[model samples]
Target: MALGAHRIPPGKAWQDPAVVFAPSVLRLMERVTEEPHPDYVGLLSGHGASRPGRVELSARGRIFVGERRYPKGSPSPEPETFMTTAELAQKFRANSEGILAHECVEAILEALQGLEKVGDIRGLMRLL
Candidate 1:
């Protein structure tokens, strides 16, 4: 999905009625000024294309990840927790710090290529 394309309607609650976000995902949502990317929404909303391993969100805001689904009206299991901030930072540093510069350049190039593909010359020029 294009960056910043998913919008939470004005004055509407951010949470979709049909799905609940994991706590870590909620934290990330809180930090962002703009709406999340559609890919994130898809993953959190349990779209078949983007749902991660065994992750699912029920219509009643229950989260399930690689666990048995409880019967309707039963008590829900706790959602899977993502890494804490410190753990995430440590993992990022270990796995991504070394290639951060290269990745940034590659991302920019990819975005520019996308803009060009769509004949968005003004957008492409703004980046350059």
Candidate 2:
């Protein structure tokens, strides 16, 4: 569980090798699975009852949620009510900085936004 912490909150925990491989941490994970909360639903609620692509799991008392694709032909009820460009840009910046350098990320974003004007594909590759 700790090994994949980067995929969720407290995102950089995977970088610390000692913390991830600790015996105490492994014990905690084992205990959680063995004695999950009484009210834990641990259900994946998306698309429909028969076809749920997203999943949520509760261990001990912690709630862990993840999502991927929804079923085809089944759109979100409020599809038109989505994040604004500013919100998307904020999320992009947060996630991109984890792997790419800040300046390189900004450059790549700019290149993506201006792709139509680029005369050479190599220009985009250079930013990458």
Candidate 3:
């Protein structure tokens, strides 16, 4: 049975219905956003060549990738997950402000490659 399933006392409100979110998604979201209003975003795990898919910033700024059917570690392109992630390939948004994830990742790696680099979150944040 799924965690967080509504349990009943054989006659209680615990059986009202399953909560909207699965326990796992809730826990992962909590961990991912633990930085306190951190600049959060999404990335596609599977490549486009395998089958078109995408990850996007939901209106709530939560990372939503394809449908629930296409969740992480699940098999790719289950038909229900046929999505176009090309539009998202060159773009990433933070707090609804658009930016480029590829360029940002590149910049971060570049900064890390510097000879005088010190391992610091602030230093990395500057790359974005």
Candidate with maximal TM-score: 2
RMSD of each: 18.4, 7.2, 17.5
Model 3: per-residue Cα lDDT over 35-104, one tens digit each: 2122122323334323223334444667554324243334565664443443232222222133446567
Worst 10 residues of 2 by lDDT: 43-52
**By TM-score, how accurate is candidate 3?**
0.19
- Write down the worst ten-residue block by lDDT for model 1: 1-10
Total clashing pairs for each candidate: 0, 0, 0
Of the two candidates 1 and 2, the one with more favorable TM-score, higher being better, is: 2
Query: Cα miss at 103, model 3 (Å)?
Result: 4.3
Each candidate: what lDDT? 0.42, 0.57, 0.42
Q: Across residues 1-128, which tens digit of lDDT does each residue of candidate 1 receive?
A: 11111343222233434323545545655654433344565554653223323333333577543432332223334233334545444444444334566555454456644654656566545543
What is the per-residue lDDT of model 2 for residues 1-128, given as tens digits with 9 covering 90 to 100?
54443244443445567777677767655644333433234333322322334445776899777654333234445444355656556666877666778988787777777789878889779767
Global local distance difference test of model 3: 0.42
- The TM-score measured for candidate 2 stands at 0.45
Instruction: Give TM-scores for every candidate, taking all chains together and pairing residue i with residue i.
Output: 0.19, 0.45, 0.19
Candidate 2 stretches greater than 4 Å from native: 1-19, 22-24, 34-99
For candidate 1, the clash count comes to: 0
TM-score of model number 1: 0.19
